[model samples]
Target: MHAHRKTRPPANLGPWQRLLLLWLLGPLLWLQARHVRRITPRMPEPPGQRAGSAGQGSLIRLLVAGDSGAAGVGAPTQEQALCGQLVRRLSRHHRVEWCVLAVNGLDSPGLHQLLLDTPEAAFDVVVLSMGANDATALCAPLQWACWQSRLADLIALRFAPALLMHSAVPPMHACLALPQPLRWFMGRWAQQMNLSLAALLIEKVGRSMHWHPSTTTTAGMAADGFHPSAAGYALWAEGLSQHILAAQIASRHHPDLKPCSAAAIAH
Candidate 1:
């Protein structure tokens, strides 16, 4: 997911530390995975316009990108999802232009490729909602960090957004659909994945990015209990808005945003 699409991938962190221990419960977990898949309701991306303009004042362009979370799966409308809530709040004092480019099950690599294909556009702020799909897909934490670093660089070169925010992974340990050991395992992996991502942002892409979500979302907060609901989106949006407001993006201090070509930026 870096300048190395034609080169070798990053080193695996070896198996999860508990992988061997969990192997003993393999058969049970296997069946549980299938059973959960069968019973879990398939959620459709909630409906509403994916692009719009709102509020009045200084123009602040925004883009919300990632997996189904960015696509608004649980909420009935985009207006109630992350993008909608974020726009509603930001629009109060700034003219907000927003768009969402996300799919139901996209992981880091998919988003990377998708962004490369998207026409370049400048944005004042960009909020990312991802990691759950990658964690569930068993993507190694180091590899995820590698891809995510490249993603950050791509966003800088492509969109040149002054503020790049990453929302924390949703709480999967409390997902009602997953069972016992499987849930525990997934939850642990997600925690590790989040930690690795945070490290990458601070140590590598720290330029002008924010890695924290305002609140910790617990279980069963969404329509399907696997995705966030309206209230959940509102909480997340509040945190993001606060950070953006505090940054006072209208002023020039975030040199992190650059419109240089991909090769010119460090991944």
Candidate 2:
């Protein structure tokens, strides 16, 4: 017996409705991307220290990635750079094999692409210091966000450190001695970029992410008058060291860890 069935309403919406949906969803998708990016670390955490007997120690490997500041462009030697100082500090508590995968003049986008081109390997901890160059370029927020998203994807897929720390853009205004327009624009752009980065990171990673304030500057004009000198890197490293130590403290206190061996930790 064939019965007559009632036709249902059209499942598809009108053009206006579709357009409205797209308009509303565009911003939402951007925000969602930022959130997704935050949860994933761009690089692997320093390797977890394997526990030995009660009084034995553990070893860790750290991967540092970023731009000139991260690369310590003005530092005379590797030991004087940001990465070197960081390893020196962390070595006080754990056996550290620190490797820096950094470059000079890289913006957020460049760093993201570099990670894409790298081999997939895990590290114990990852420190990312990017966006300074991007600030100088005066990139739009959306563009920066796009690079950040790519970075997040790389971290999610390959290297996710047990802990990830992102440093804040340092004050370019310390170069305020320059003429009005250049100084004004550079300082304003940097401030905006920092603000955007901080907000996005906090929203996504919550407390899992740490922020290092790069307050050091060459108000007196270092050699280049652009990059920070050894003293400037020193101040930057000092601030970063404090945060890394805090993260390490939690790892050390974890029940799975054995007593830290002084010799191993100091290495």
Candidate 3:
């Protein structure tokens, strides 16, 4: 589903204020990171088959790409993560052949570079789970916007999926693993980045691009309180399936339209 835009200004600190804030908050941020590391053991991305086909219908080529969340880190296997969940849901209507291209800590620009390096392949749908790492790395909103725009351009130039779905930045403020000001800070940054991303998508890809908000709750968090639990992945997949179905309906009505083309989305 498309996200409504808010007209608030960016939340980044002014130059001098940023310097002062960093000088004061840097030590605390470091401490919080260390404390979180001590409490939350690193979890490997779920292992198992990444490619599979199911159901009997028109073939749907799907690509799930991004970071740890996309890699299904919290779940025991890919079958329990977002990719598997999505494939299962979509397979009810379409024979889905899905592949996942993700890593543990990839940011927006990193994902874009990876897509560029990979060989081109057409996909019926593309789902991206990103931005949390970017927020953690303190990527500036302007920088994130630029990278997101470039990523959109690359997608248009390359995969050109009928629908492109972007998972919204997670609710970092609600993360139990993060310490006070650090969580607060990352949350604000994530909000800013998400806003920038939404605007860019609306401008560039329009209706062909869908934004799915975080459906995760406190109880849906994994042991680390950072990644999503299996329940959270199910919720995410359910929402995504709805949007994909909508896009499929729209495409059916406009058969001549090139899905995800700049001109098509601009309208």
Report the CA-based lDDT of candidate 3 relative to the real structure. 0.72
* Per-residue lDDT of candidate 2, residues 21-109 (tens digit): 54765465445435534653232122222212221146565666788767766666657667777776767777775667677778886
Over 1-267, each residue of candidate 3 has an lDDT whose tens digit, in order, gives 112322232265544654576688999998988888788878899887776667768777777888998899888889999889988898899877677888888999789888887666656777888888888888877688777667767876677676777777776766667888887677667776777777776655432344445333555667887888787787778888888876672212224333232221210
lDDT of candidate 1 over 63-153, digit per residue (tens)? 8899988898888899998899999999998988788888899999899998898777667787888888888777777777687778889
In candidate 2, stretches whose alpha carbon ends up further than 4 angstroms from where it belongs are 1-57, 176-178, 206-221, 249-267
Q: Positional deviation of 133 in candidate 2, in angstroms?
A: 1.5
Report every candidate's CA lDDT.
0.71, 0.56, 0.72
TM-score for candidate 2, residues paired by index? 0.65
Clashes of each: 0, 13, 0
lDDT of 1 at 157: 82
Residue 164 lDDT, candidate 2, scale 0-100: 67
Q: How accurate is candidate 1 locally (lDDT)?
A: 0.71
Regions of model 3 farther than 4 Å from truth: 1-23, 206-218, 249-267
